[model samples]
Target: MTTEQHIRHRADGSIDTAFYTSQGRTRRSEAAHSMARGVIGPLVILFSFGTLVALLV
Candidate 1:
């Protein structure tokens, strides 16, 4: 059995490192925003509840 190795070549005959790096950075930014929202959403909910309770009392 012969093993085959996959090779990638860009149209310009140069390595497309920048394109892959940019994609990775974009994904990382998206993950960070998702995490921030997860934390901030709950805090906002709690704050609103506290404010309403205080006003009623």
Candidate 2:
């Protein structure tokens, strides 16, 4: 087998490289989600308050 294939498969015939890649991707996605929420959350609150004020006036 090639070196790439060897790294992907272990002696027990299970995939190992995928787990590491998947964990990395999950962590990246979680971080992005947290950042987006941090930015959008305040904007949403501000917009809602402005709308309420506009309606009251």
Top model by lDDT, which number? 1
lDDT of candidates 1 onward, in order: 0.90, 0.89
User: In model 2, which runs have C-alpha deviations exceeding 4 angstroms?
Assistant: 1-9, 12-15
TM-score: model 1 vs. ground truth: 0.75
The TM-score between candidate 2 and the true structure equals 0.72
Per-candidate Cα RMSD to the true structure, in Å, reads 3.5, 6.3
For model 1 the local lDDT of residue 9 reads: 56
**Model 1: per-residue lDDT, tens digit, 1-57?**
999975455798887787778888999999999999999999999999999999999
Candidates in order, TM-scores: namely: 0.75, 0.72
Per-residue lDDT value at 4 in model 2: 50
Residue pairs with colliding backbones in model 1 are none
Over 1-57, each residue of candidate 2 has an lDDT whose tens digit, in order, gives 646543466678887877779889999999999999999999999999999999999
